[model samples]
Target: MITTVTLNAAIDKTYVLSDFQLGKVSRIGQIHAVAGGKGINAARVLHQLGIRTLATGFVGGSNGDFILKNLDQQQISHDFVKVDDESRICLNIMNASNGESTELLEKGPLITEQQLAEFRQKIVLLGQQSRIVIFSGSIPAGLSTSVYAELIEALRKTNAAVFLDTSGDGLIHGLKAAPFFMKPNEDEIAQLTGKRPENETELVQSLHQLADSGIECASVSLGASGSMTVYKGTIYRVRVPSIEALNPVGSGDAYVAGMAAGIYQELPIEDCLRLAAACGTANALSAHAGFVKREDVDAFLKQIEIVQL
Candidate 1:
């Protein structure tokens, strides 16, 4: 089983509009409220892929209850630690007029020290049972950036592979533990390496730097163009097929889920890159957050072109 950890889970509310005018009223084209957070998304994708997954994390209050109910209805098994404070809500405003999306996010509930310890214990117990543990998204307040790093170290002893997808200090600190896999978009990778890839060769070097840091596999998303992954000192570039792109919000999360799927199956390096890039492209063809259609993924899987760098 794969265990996904969402330290700062939220109820993702998406509002779609034909066109959004500045400081003006806009009619809602559609609206969707779903269980969200990076790890939650990964779990949903894994479950859709017929993979047995257990999602564990911190949640609280009514919003938290709503998330649990939704997951339950979806038949996705989860065991989130309950806290006194309320969890957060993330709002996404997608303007179809110009194909743009703006998001407003809330810092999640401030977890208490006792709550922290309980969640930590939960993770360890769950990690012991799972073959892989996925750690993703931002942490709530009242915790240090080293939380994931510490968790990685602790879980590594259990022999379960760890994969992470997060940014900023959380990612910077977590790298010290050397996870099995990490998926950071191009900008995040540039921020960490202090170098932006101006061309394919530079990009390959940057990915190599990450793999040299001891991460078994490292990947970066290149928005619409595609993505790149490095494994065991080898770099692979995945070129995504062009399609009518709708939204790019959750594609990165989908990519992470695909990577987890590949690792769990022990797929070849090229196949791993293909699956990850295909899943991301599939997610972009829809307006939903962290979602993808199997038909799209399968069709796009054949369209992906992977080249060894």
Candidate 2:
């Protein structure tokens, strides 16, 4: 089974408006809310892909209750550590006419040291049962940047391979644990290597540098342009066909889910990249975050082109 970690889970609400103008009282056309956070989003995608996934993290209060209920309604399994503080609520205001989205994020509840310890113990047990343990998203307010690194090190005792998807210092510190796989976008890649890649050539070079640092696999997401991935000392460029994107919020998480699913099935590197790209593209076509129909993935898979770089 795959285990996903979401330390700062939240209820993601998307408000669709005909004309979302700032400083104006706009009428909401529609609203969609779901259990979210990078890992939860990925878990939801994994579940849709017929994968056995267990989501674990911190949650609390009415918002947290709503998150759990939503997950239950979706038939997604979860085991979260409850806290006294309320979980966060993130808003995505979508402009229906222009297809543009603006996001307002909240810093989640403060986690006590005791709660953090309990979570670590839980991960140790979950890691033992999981084939792949994914650490995603930001750490909560009270946790240090080294949290993922610490957890990854603890999970090292288990047989599970670690897949990390995060940004900033969390990504920097998590690198110390040498996870098996990581997917960072272009800007994140620049932050890690301290060099802004001018083009795909430079991006491939950055990926190779990451590989040299003991990471088994690394991929740099290029939004609509697709991605560049490196596995087993080889770089592959993934090309995704354009589509009318309804909401692209969780495309990255969907890509991670697809990659993890492929790895769990032990598919070839090329096939894995194809699946990952297809899932990401499929996510853009959907209105919900981290959601994709299996048929959409299959159709997109046939259209994706991967070439060796």
Candidate 3:
């Protein structure tokens, strides 16, 4: 079993418009709402790939009710702890005319100390049974940046591999726990290393330097340019063939899902990168978050190229 922890989950709502103009009336072509947060997104993708996943986190109020129902409709198993505060709603507005997207995110409900203790207990129990325990997304209000570090430490007795995906202080603090894998962008990588890479050469070098800190694998997202990763003391560059992307949101989460799936399956490092990139590309080609038709993944899997650098 795989356990995903989303400290802050939301009712992710996406709106599509031919042209989204500020201070002007524009008709929306479509709207969709689903359970969301980085961990939730990854769990959805994992479920789509036929992986057994249990999503655990804090949820509350009517908004939390909506999230649970959405998960039930999708047949995804979730074990969320209810709280007094309401969960958040995240909005994604896409403008087809400009090929741009604007996001309005909500800082989720603050968690009480008692709620934090309850959630931490859940994490330790779940981690013991899970093969991979993924901790993703931003830390909500009323929580310190070191919260993940503490949670990770609590699960240190378990054999599950930890996958940490976060930015800023969350990522920095979580490092002390030494996650098995980490996926950070270029800027976040620089922030950690305290040096800005001048070019791709420096970027790859930075990735190598990070691995030296005891992180087994470090994968860096390069957006449309694909990604670079270090695994088993080898550096590789991943590239995906071109495809018209309807919506690129959640691609990163999809990538994490694929990587986790690969790790769970004990695939080769190259195959891991191949699967990860394939899922990310498939997500970009979809109109929704955390969804990729199996056929689409199969078709795109062939176009992905992986090379050791």
Per-prediction TM-score, please? 0.97, 0.99, 0.97
- Root-mean-square deviation of each candidate, in angstroms? 1.1, 0.7, 1.1
For candidate 3, give the lDDT of residue 263: 95
- Reference-based lDDT, residue 231, model 3: 85
Q: Assess candidate 1 and give its lDDT.
A: 0.89
Candidate 3 regions with alpha-carbon error over 4 angstroms? none
Pairwise lDDT winner, candidates 2 and 3: 2
**Candidate 1: 10-residue stretch with minimal lDDT:** 183-192
Residue-level lDDT of model 3, residues 73-152, one tens digit each, is 99999999899888999999999887688989999988999999999888989998999999999888899999989998
Position 8, candidate 3: lDDT: 92
Sequence-dependent TM-score of model 2: 0.99
For model 3 the local lDDT of residue 162 reads: 96
Tell me the tens digit of each residue's lDDT in model 1 across 1-309.
Answer: 999999999999999998988799888979999999989988988888778998889999999999999999888999999988898999899998898999999999998889889988888899989989999999899988999998998897687899989988989988889999988887789777988788888888888899888988898889888988888888888899988889888888889888888888989878878888888888888787788889988998999998886
Which residue pairs collide in model 1, if any?
A: none
lDDT of 2: 0.94
Query: What does candidate 1 score on TM?
Result: 0.97
User: Stretches of candidate 1 above 4 Å error?
Assistant: none
What is the C-alpha local distance difference test score of each model?
0.89, 0.94, 0.90
Q: Who is ahead in lDDT, 1 or 3?
A: 3
